[model samples]
Target: MASQKIATLVLVLGLLIMPFSIASYAQIPCNTVYNDLYPCLGFVMGGGKVDPACCSGFKTVLGLAKTKTDRQGVCSCLKSLVSDATDGEIKNAAQIPKLCGLNIPYVISRNIDCSK
Candidate 1:
């Protein structure tokens, strides 16, 4: 319950503040990014095989990140999505892209510098 509350707060905060964080330069919306990546939660939060749906979503989200700011906004949304994740969970999450056979331009981590 406590973790759920934290997750909710992080999502809400991200939704509320994401625009200000990347609005000037980002063309993609965090909500869209959120919806696109939600499918990966199962594999990311759990120790299991990655789903094809999650990979499909992953491809879509990565495809949308066309610019530096777009990537930053996507990163910010991803951080919010897994804000309550344990270190192991984050590691699992980070492996999804590679497991899906997709390459990204940024490092996947809880401490990712979205500004970069």
Candidate 2:
């Protein structure tokens, strides 16, 4: 159960690490970020097991960023979601990448600065 909660938080955190610029991401619009993230919301908000589909979506989204603008865009998006999370929640969420066997360039933390 504890692991489940952690996994849930991590999935949501992972969702905030991708870029969605249509031109850069092969026409992936920013709004569609929500579509991929939809399934993880319930788990992220309520605390439970993270879904495999959620991780799959996360992987696809994470792969979209390929430039500085992309990183900044993803960072901007991450800031909003990170704001609503508690320290513990953020810690758990940051663990998603590792849990999913992925390595991201940036660290997902509450204090993360999007401008960098």
Q: Which model scores highest in TM-score? A: 1
State the local distance difference test value for candidate 1: 0.72
Best by lDDT: 1
Encode model 2's per-residue lDDT on 1-116: one tens digit a residue.
67755664675555545454323333344545546655656555554677777677668767776766766666555545656566656665576667667777677776777666
Residue 6 local lDDT, model 1: 61
Please give me the total number of clashing residue pairs in predicted model 1: 0
Lowest summed lDDT across 10 adjacent residues in model 2 is found at 18-27
Task: Score candidate 2 by TM-score against the native.
Answer: 0.63
TM value for model 1: 0.75
- Number of backbone-clashing residue pairs for each candidate, in the order shown: 0, 0
| Every candidate's CA RMSD | 3.7, 7.0
lDDT at 54, model 2: 68
